[model samples]
Target: MKGFITDPLQIERESMRIIRGYLQQDWTEKELKIVERCIHTSGDPTLESVIRIHPQGIEAGLKSLQQGAPVITDVEMVRAGIAKKQLSQLGGTAECFLSDPRVADQAVELGITRSMAALRLNKERLKGAIVAIGNAPTALLEVLELAKDPETRPALVVGIPVGFVGAKESKDLLWEEHPELPSITILGNRGGSPLAATCVNALIYLAVNREI
Candidate 1:
């Protein structure tokens, strides 16, 4: 019997091999990396079913990272999950505005969701940044609204918030309302911090590997 694989690199390679074997549809190299990472993170092959990417979204994401654009995450978990070392290496940073006290105050003052208020507070930072929203439907909705203003639009929006309430509707609005923006999303109400982080990490990996 062969010994259990202990090397991390070897383990990752073997895992990717397995993930590739299970996938039947042909995907570009970059797409495969993103999808496989999502599968690896979630241990769910079904993730591929709902993963949707805009035509130029991947390339736009890569370019943004290469330019050292900031990454704005809606929640702390998503921020924590990001590969900060990799982002730093690319001359970028990951930030989360949801915890700011000003966000709470503004939410109440503006009669908006805290997530929406957070986006409003970080509107300047969000400009040309890679915005990742994985936990709140309201955050995604806020991105859609902010996109209408040229100065506040993000370079790429990873809009995959998870919930049954407004998640599906928010993503649908993204597709319907902002077809011109570069984005990646899960079609249904089935996404989370891990998947959102995976999407951003995949983009970081693409930058590190010079695949874009």
Candidate 2:
């Protein structure tokens, strides 16, 4: 147990100090906070290179949270990982519809993924909401497709689905093709629910901007 630190706050501070030593990007403070939180949660220094952030991503998330926008996720795990207690203090909410019977029925009828069906059935909630998609590329793709309607405006999209399938392609399209879309993503198929949840948490941390 030599040189071991048990205090959570001290551990976080030390971890962040070490993480900062390796990150030399010219990102803004809020963007850097997201990067730091991702690196801390993932424990992978290489992620610094693959992380992508749209210019409006951080600001958009912050603004939405401040305005009490709900956070919609593709899966239960991502929803479960969010800081719901803190979000409640801000009058914000988080939800996941994977378990909804409508999701199952729509998925079977449409011959698409349940992740895709969740978004398809909840298009109304996507408007000005914070959408977090961390487990399914199909969901991210569906979100992008719905976003093209000129009415749905997700404040920020944490599109970090981890898989060998359409994960990279979905994020690639979001970062490359859709410049106006507000999103934070990890390129090259390296993502998961934790990253998606923590990315949103980082935005919340910024919104409150105090020791929690």
lDDT of 1 by residue, 1-212 (tens): 38999888888989988888888677898888888998899898887887888888999999999999999999999999999998999999999987888988899888989989988887988888999999999999888888889899899999999989999999988867788999999888888999899999999989998332
Among residues 3 or more apart in sequence or in different chains, the pairs in candidate 2 whose N, CA or C atoms overlap within 3 Å are none
Give the clash count for each candidate. 0, 0
What would the TM-scores of all predictions be? 0.94, 0.97
Q: What is the lDDT of residue 183 in candidate 2?
A: 93
lDDT of 2 by residue, 1-212 (tens): 88899999999999989999999688887788889999999999889999999888888999999999999999999999999988887789999888778988899998999999988888889988999999999999999998887677687888999999988999998899988888999999799999999999998888887552
Candidate 1, lDDT over the whole model: 0.89
Model 1 CA lDDT for position 18: 89
Task: Name the best candidate (by TM-score).
Answer: 2
- Give candidate 1's error at residue 157 in angstroms: 0.4
